[model samples]
Structures are given as C-alpha cells and as structure tokens.
Target: MRNTSDISISVVVSCTAQTAALLPWTLKAVMAQTSPSHDIIVVENSAVPELPSMPAREARRLRLLHLPGAARPALRNAGLAAAQGVLVAFCDSGDLWKPSYLAIMREMWRVEPRLLLAYGDAVPLQGDTWGTERGFANAPTGFWDGQRSLGPLLSVFDQPPMPRLLEFQPFLPSGLVAQRGFLERVGGWDTACTLLPGHDFATALRLARHALFGIMQRAMVGVRPEADGPAHAQAVNMGEARILERALARDETLWSQAQVIRAAIVRRRQAALAIAFARGDLAAVQEIAALLPQQERSSPTLLKLGLAALPAPLRRAGSAALFGLGASRTSLRWPGN
Candidate 1:
C-alpha cells in the first residue's frame, strides 16, 4: 500500500442511459478535483454508447468500462482490480463535486493513516425547483437547497446508527474515498446484495466496525433528485430490500445486525408509503405498495394516526389488519376513496 501523502485516488463514477443528462455535470466535477493526481473511472452500465468528451480533450489515465447494469457494484470491483491509485472514491453520475473534494479527502487520510474511509456532505438538485449555484452565498435560507437530516451519523467510529441505511447512511457514497487496501481487505461490495438499500452505507458500516475511519465536516458534492420521481423511489425500495436480504444471507455473523437494520428500514419505507397516501399521491402510494412482498410493509405511525381518528372498536379491528394494504389492494386503496 502507498502512503496517503503520495496517494492518487481512483475515482469511480456510476452511469446509465437514464443518467446521461448528468454525465457532463458529474464527470466535469470529478475532473475538477483539486489534486491533479486523481484518476477518473466512468462505469457505463446503460446500453447507450460512452459519453462524448471531445477528442480534443485529454485524460492520460481516464478510462471507461461497460458494466451493463445500473447496479454496477461488480464493475466497481473490477475498477479496484485495475486501479493504480492508493485510494478509491465512489461518485454517482448525477452528482457534482466541490473543488477540493479529492484534495481534502487525501489530506485527511494522510493526516490519519489508520483512517479507513472518509466522506462529507452532499447537496442535492431536484429539477426546476432550485437556483444556479451562482449567488448561493447570500441566500437567507442557506446555500444548500435540500440538506438531508441524516448526514452526520456515519462520521464516527462508534454510535447507535439510525435504523435504515438509506434513511441515515453514515456515509453517502458520492464524495467518499476509501483506502484501496481496506476495500480489498474487507472484500468489495457484497455481490449477493442483488438489490439492497445501502451498498455504500452497508459497506461503510462494515468497515467502520472493523477498521479505523475518519470524517471531515465539509460540503463535497451535488446530488440530483427528480421532482416527485416515483420510479426512483420504487427502484430505491427494490434496491434496499434486495440489499438487506443479501446482507443477511452473506454474513451469518452479521445477520442479527442486518435484521435490526432491515426492520428499521422497513418501517421507514412503510411510513413513506403512508405519507404518499395521505398526501393523495396515488402513484407513489401504489408503487410503494406494490414494490415488495406482502408481509414486508407497515405504517405504524400512519396506522396510529388512522386509529386515533377512528372509534376504538374500528381502530382495533382496522389496525389489526393493517388496512389490508398490500400489492393486491394497492390500486384499490388510493387516498381519495
């Protein structure tokens, strides 16, 4: 392994046909890293041809790999094999980075050689709902448009993490850099996690427990969110469920911990569905209702709210059945009716 001060990070960015709109933004951001030594890896999992950076542009070590799946954890593993850098940073295609991203992360690792992973804040962009980064400093509300509530959980060596990996991941994948040796030591993403909520979070969780890690309180990237994007949520849920299931099967030793995390995530997802229902989001409600197994959904808070509004007898009966909400009745139970 190379020393942190001398480390060159191999940055891996994920892309698909659907995320093409973000290529210019994401790659340019990664390319803009302060430290000139970092290399960029663009993994194209979509059927679309590789992104067009003019032939006139130069990337001495820039490379692109075709992975053929949106879930390119496998491709990431391959990148690990091909990487010449001492560290690896994961970037998502639809995200942008702060100018000092690579430099700051490298400095942090160099300062603390035992640190296994390090990451910071991510600012998200939802279409048509925000402003250009210009004049961001003077905004009274704050420069960040939508700051997630759970960014701080993963910045530690020990703490009771929020239950769901998706809801409060200690480390958001984008902007996170890990020592190449640690990644190889722990083994890469759990391939068995065909789909699960926190590939990044889960990996970090495992690493934090087993290795020394570090955190920097700085803003590092821009994540894009689609306005009321239903399919995205569905994919998110599908991905989480699959990942959690895989986590359980992958490490029998961690099955107990995985169960705790999955239960919390399940409840979180169920609450999301109920919120969509109460807000009369027929599509989101239906999608959330249909995205997983019957025994897998719940909205205890919503159920309690519903029960609170009802006579005790009806509340008891209704609550007992969970309003019979599941894939079969999803279409039948939209909020309006």
Candidate 2:
C-alpha cells in the first residue's frame, strides 16, 4: 500500500465474457478521467478471457488480471488484493463514469483528509431511454443539490439529532472512491455476500461505522440496466432485506436510523411486487411477499395480486391503468416532468 499522503487512485473493474460488448465503452470512460489513474486493473471473471483489445493510451494504464472460473464478488476481492495505490475505486464493465468522477473524488479527499469515501449521483439508462435510479430520484435536496454545507466532511453519525435519512438508494461500487487503508481495514468485500448479492451494502455499513462519508453534487456514472429477469426477483429483494437485518443485528447504535432505511426498502419492495403481479409472475410475487411485513402486503397490493391471475390481456390492461407501465422504473419521480 502507498503512503496516506499519496492521492493516486487504482480502479478495479469487474469484467466477464458476458459483458464483452460493454467493456470497451467503460474503459474509454476511465481513460477520460480528468485525474489520471495510477492503474486500472480489470479482473476477468470467466473460464475464458474475452475482453477486446485496449487502445494504446488505455492499455498503458490498464492491466488485465484473470481469475478464470471465479464468481463476480470473488473477482472483485481478487482485484482488491492486487491493488497497489493509496486510493481505490470500483467500476463494472458496463457502467460509465463521467470524466470528472476521479477529479471530484480527489478534490473531496484533499479538502477532508478524514473522509473515508466519496460518492456521486448516477443517471441510469434503461435500453434507449434515460432513467433515474433510486439514489438520484429520492435524494435529500440539501445534500445532492449542494445547498447544505458539508464543511470539511459529512457523516450521518457525526451529529447529535441525525439528519432525517431519505428513502434513497445507497451508493453502489461503480460510483465510489475510498482510501486504500480504509478499504483494507474493512476486510474488503464480504465474499459470502455473493449468495445474498448485497456485498456493497454490507461493506458500506462497515465503513459508516468508523469513518466519514462525502456526497458529491453531480451525477458521476451512467448505470447500465440490469439484465436479470423476474426469475431472480426473490433473491434481489431478499438480499436487500438481509443486509439490513444483518446490520441491525450487529450495530445497536444504528437501530433507529436503520429502521427508516428498512421502511424505505419495504416501500420499494412493495412497488416491485406490483410490477411482478402485473406480469403475472406469481412465483416471484409469492417469494417477495413472504419477505415483507404483513401490513406491507396491503389490501391494494393483494388486490393487484388477484388481478394478475386473470387472463394475460386483462392483466396487462389492468396493470397499465393501475400502475402505469412507464412509471414502474421511475415511480419515485411520477406525477409531472
């Protein structure tokens, strides 16, 4: 590891054969960073390497580290182990970072040496259209909008009457940059979370306990749409709930704060169940429903569940009227423009 004074960053990118088509764009975006990188380590997680050739400029900063036949979380763990810079950032093959991402992170760390990590908003992309992800959509106006003064650093645990945490999405790995020491001290990603799929959340919770967090005002990445279909809905919802459960079990100080977060997640899960019911995905609906509290499985939600059992055409028409197809992904932003 480099000295704490060293500000250079090493970026770990998770890649696989399935994402070959998207890797080039991601790499190009990394090379465009206003703050030049110390290294860009691409961790290939597949039986056979399938990444395309890198351009001369990017190839100079980029190196491929193969962990053939490894899982996604394992690939990230391997890359973290191989990192050599003072600061580390993560990006997935399909996520595109804005040119100013590393530059802003560098500035934030410089302004506050005590800050353990910094993250920015992301404008999500769904197929050909632009979409807003949970973090950006429900972000507390003062923080992300830059009205509140973060001063040197910001920590949810720093003040006495904590800020009313919003029902917003937590920052994902793709948009985060953290101190190398902090990352290592947290024991890197939870390898066991591969089954639960909330490794990022678990890691963030660990970091929040001991260090400060910074929130940048600009959107830093364009999140690629997820490809996993309804078949994995149960796992995804359950994974989020499990992460919160584990956090509450481990930290009593955060109990009150985490309850707000838990409520927000339940709301999102309820919304998700609506989508599943609209599609007549009974199995997914059943699995996800079992994870929520009885009150969350409301009369309206249950009514929708019954409607979904109707004929396909009837269900589609009912769902469109009740849920609005376009509103599903951006429900938090509904009503007007």
What ranges in model 1 sit over 4 Å off?
1-5, 46-51, 54-57, 126-167, 194-204, 226-242, 255-266, 269-273, 276-337
> How many steric overlaps are in each model, in order?
7, 0
Per-residue lDDT over 66-86 for candidate 1, one digit per residue giving the tens place of the 0 to 100 score: 877657567677677667788
Off by over 4 Å in 2: 1-6, 47-60, 125-135, 140-166, 197-199, 228-235, 249-269, 283-297, 301-337
lDDT of 2 at 15: 82
Q: Model 2 lDDT vs. the true structure?
A: 0.65
Query: Model 1 has how many clashing residue pairs?
Result: 7
lDDT values, one for every candidate:
0.57, 0.65
| Model 2 vs. true fold: TM | 0.73
Winner by TM-score: 2
